[model samples]
Target: MKLPNTAHTSRPWRIHEIAHDFLLEDVWALPTPGGPDDFPRLVRQMTSGSNTNDSRAYTALFEIRWRLGKLFGWDRPDAGIVARVPSLRDRLPADLLAGPRGPVFSSVPFTSVYQTDDEWVAEMANRTVHALMHMSWVADEGGGYHGQMAVLVKPNGWFGRGYMAAIKPIRYLVVYPALLRMIGRTWELQAAG
Candidate 1:
């Protein structure tokens, strides 16, 4: 479910230190509820492209985005991580820097940054923005845990800001709801299995 930005801002996440200047574009409460030790499972399920089926709308939207990016040179390597923007990993402390960089993403264009016991960070950059995707395992009062996700982005300039504004509605309306359903189904299946 979509969450208030404060849901992320209130937490003392390591990402805050790495991407302090980025806007909190989104915060979401994932449906993957489990025990404290289950964070690795959640992260694995997420990075493994085969774990869940994507919504057709999302797939189509992604395809469209890619096409647009290609036509506009938005996804050139020179426009990515170290070329157009500094990598967030450059800001990591020694501990985080030496820790697991998480799994290789099977489908997305994101690069794994670092991972701790309860948190994982991945990043992607293009002409429109330098962005980070952060996931955390949050404990509930009942002693169980669930996942949370936050997206942080430093838009490149006026064009980037407009790009973000253009996509906001589709992201909130179609993309996120589809992801929520997909994750919920996968979590339920994991429990049943």
Candidate 2:
């Protein structure tokens, strides 16, 4: 479900240290309730599943975004990480760098940043923004654990700011709601099996 920005900001996440300049765009309470060890399963499901295909509208939205990026050179090589902006890895402390760099995504463009038993982070960048997707397994009051997802972004400049503004309504109104339902459905299937 869509959660308040404080849902993420109030947590003592290591991401806060590195993403000080980025905005906390969104946070959602994922429906994948399970034991603490189930985080890897969540990560694996996310990496391998095609959540955007859950609905025609979702697929169309993604296609339109991809086409726009291609046409406008928003995702061009020179516009990405280590090209236009320095990677968040550069800011990581020695301990985080020495640990296992998380899983490589199978379908998306994100690169692993770090992974621990309770938390995982991945990053991606384009002309519009340098973004981070953070997932954490948090203990629920009811005795089990559930997943939480937060998106953080540092917009490139004026174009970035404009692009973010234009997409805000669509993102919150359509994309995120569908995404939450998709995650719930997938988690049910995964748990059943």
Top model number, lDDT: 1
Per-residue lDDT value at 9 in model 2: 86
Provide the lDDT at 86 for model 2. 88
Per-residue alpha-carbon lDDT of candidate 2 for residues 1-193, written as tens digits (9 for 90 to 100): 8889998888888888888998989999999999978999888877775443467787799999999999999999898889988888999989889997887788778888887777888899999999999999988899999999999999888998998999999998888888888988888987887
Clashes of each: 0, 0
Each prediction's TM-score versus the true structure: 0.95, 0.96
What is the TM-score of candidate 1? 0.95
Q: Candidate 1 — what's its lDDT?
A: 0.90
Error of 2 at 48 (Å): 1.7
Off by over 4 Å in 1: none
